[model samples]
Target: MRQVDRHPGKAEIPAGELWLVVDSGVKKWACLSCPGGCGVQISLSLNPEHRPRWKVEQDFWRRPTISPSIHQQKMCRCHFWIRKGQIEWCKI
Candidate 1:
């Protein structure tokens, strides 16, 4: 996935029909979809104190992209995916 800065204009990141990575740190979550386009949201907390969970409904969708692939999409470095529990340590 391409990394992007989390500025005022850049908040939401859509991860195709697979998943959408949201937020950072131990309490991270990704919005997923079933094969038939059914929404299946799941969250995973890398920290032991936190719990890995799943949500049925999420706010993730396919955003308009100039290019087809996510790699070709323009994004800020801060908007990329960081390790589940190590997001705080990530640097742009």
Candidate 2:
């Protein structure tokens, strides 16, 4: 997904777009839609001091790679990984 440097809105973002919220030059959050097609918004914390935080790396092409995996406890409950701007679904 394309990483955008901005705050996440209360509404749903466009497909294939991820928001990287930066506050005062510090990366704070990563927001995106559920790749499972559930249309749920997922916000990940980027702060190192947070309990549940994910590391976001972008290649020179602007493709995003998120460390570990994303598991939605509610809604679709889809677990997946974002690597090189592609979604890799985890086996159930």
Candidate 3:
């Protein structure tokens, strides 16, 4: 998927897509349609107040670079990481 800095509500983000929602220039959070075919909206904070948050960076190509990893403790329980615009699944 591609990266966008738009106000989340204004964009028609696709399913299983990654969206970077920000306020002004500060990244507020990252969101995506759950990749496990659950169709649930998974949102992770980039704010310092939330623990175990993630970060995102984008290159000129518009692809995204996400850091650390993402682990869903809830439904589907998917675990993976996005690095340099590629999703790397964790063998969990």
Candidate topping lDDT: 2
The sequence of per-residue lDDT tens digits that candidate 3 reaches over residues 2-53 is 4467646645457757877767778888888766666566677888777878
Arrange candidates by TM-score, highest first: which order?
Answer: 2, 3, 1
TM-score of 1: 0.24
Specify the highest-TM-score model's number: 2
**Cα lDDT of model 3 overall?**
0.73
Error of 1 at 72 (Å): 30
Local distance difference test, per candidate? 0.28, 0.85, 0.73
- What does candidate 1's lDDT look like per residue over 1-92, in tens digits? 33222221333334343233444522233332221223332232223354433322222342312111111122221222232211222233
Clashes of each: 9, 0, 0
Q: TM-score of every model? A: 0.24, 0.89, 0.76
- In model 3, pairs of residues that clash are none
How big is the positional error of residue 78 in model 1, measured in Å on the Cα after superposition? 32
Residue 8 miss distance in model 3 (angstroms) = 4.6
Clashing pairs in model 1?
3-76, 3-77, 4-75, 4-76, 4-77, 4-78, 4-79, 5-76, 5-77
Instruction: Write candidate 2's Cα lDDT for 9-89 as tens digits.
Output: 777877788888887778888898887788888999999999799999999998899987999777999999999989999
